[model samples]
Target: MNVSQTMETEEDFLTRLHIKLYHPQQSCKGLYGMLPLGKRSSHPADVPLRLGRDAQACTYALVDPRVSRKQLALHAYRTAQSPDMLFTIQNLSQRGRLSVNSSALGYLERMDLPDKALLRFGEYEMLITRESGEAMGSFEVEFEVLEMPPSRETCMCVPSVTPVMELRALVPLENDETLCHL
Candidate 1:
């Protein structure tokens, strides 16, 4: 296939994505520990949502010193084969890695997202779920964003080291290391 046929532009998708919160059942810290759970945010139409620490560039600015400035891009799309809107996600962070549904994605890597996807980077995690409420054959897809509870086993704020038999193991980050603390 030609480049034009294979690589479609944003306008080709012909759909928009809105990220909202439907239920606020649980209480938990959100982005930067300030955006509480279930908080709602609007997304720009005809453009991918930029998420990262760079407020000037990113649509969703996360507060994380350890995380890179420009992290992820979420693009909404649709095809002639299906009326339902789909999405493609790209990893923009140069230093940090993005794990989508347990699949690791390095810088510049992208993947076609499923209906429900869990995006994890560093100590932060973003949950995007598709909600179809339309009765028509052509489904209208809306997405919801939520912050998942931090995993205790992999908490970065407080580095926990297991007791080791050897004294060498006691010395952690022997010379230098990069880690997120809170």
Candidate 2:
């Protein structure tokens, strides 16, 4: 197939990426909500997603005072490295700290995310998972064949060696040439 066709195949396998913010069931007095990133609910997937305690960030509004106005930002898009969507996160909080699976993120630092990455901001924590149709589809197509070189020598001929004296007693050889003396 042509270059465009190859890319189109890869695109079809990629799913749209999004973040899922799951509130601890007991943290909000049993009144909890999960926020999925998208534009329909004012959560723009293409733009930097603003998250924090500010009521203005209705897309991902957190009521906890410990969360800064803009604690974290997420940007999602299709990446050329893999057939699955990738995401990058930016720490926007001044006092709050951000971490992915226990790895701390510095202020304003951006880092690519992996599947099922756990994010923590102050007292809140969320899990990031795929949100598109392809995420649930068969993953067999995502793998590419990798060509590797042979690991050992490939000689086919049997090595030549002198016949032992014990063998000569059982079956006599007329000449050393017949024994493949080389």
Candidate 3:
């Protein structure tokens, strides 16, 4: 099949684009998840999704009473320098304070959000991260802390000749008779 003959769906095109919203606050644990952009509208008015408490008025809803029905908006803008869509968040709530990376935004104000940016609406917090092209990769790390052995001597000035038991590493021997030689 010719490349031009292949019809691309909105979901297929969106796979190339890495855009999502996630909640990462301690107060609201397990609320953390990614909300991916699935489609785009041809009409200009149809674009830009709104999020809030009310079920009908928002694309993404927050059930908390402290959140307004129309809390914020997620809009996309393209620039001459890059072909990828850039996103900016607009604050629409009257009572709810919107913040980007801990900086408060004025009412009806908009701010550019970068990848891995922290967004806060009152106590609700969300993280916006986009991984595109070759930069998309994840890794895991493990760490352990080793504790020191307790000493019999309490005074800091005095040095004890007694060896600390916990500081030694025990080696395994296959035969029990070999232990007496050491």
RMSD in Å for model 3: 17.5
Model 1 residue 34 CA deviation (Å) reads 7.6
Tens-digit lDDT track of model 1 for 1-182 = 78988886544443333333222332444434422234434344357777778888876665556658888987766678875667789999988999876779988999998765656777665556665322222222343444434332233323346333443454466432223222
lDDT of 2 by residue, 158-180 (tens): 12253566444644345431122
Best by lDDT: 1
Give the TM-score of each candidate. Answer: 0.56, 0.52, 0.52
lDDT of 2 at 89: 82
lDDT of 3 by residue, 1-182 (tens): 98866976443323122223433343363232222235432213226667777768776565566678899886766668775555678998987798776568878899886754556676554545543321112211111111211111111112235344422223234533112112
Candidate 1 runs further than 4 Å off: 1-39, 133-182
Candidate 3 stretches with Cα past 4 Å from truth are: 1-10, 15-46, 132-182
lDDT of 3 at 17: 24
Tell me the whole-model lDDT of each prediction, alpha carbons only.
Answer: 0.57, 0.51, 0.49
Number of backbone-clashing residue pairs for each candidate, in the order shown: 0, 1, 0
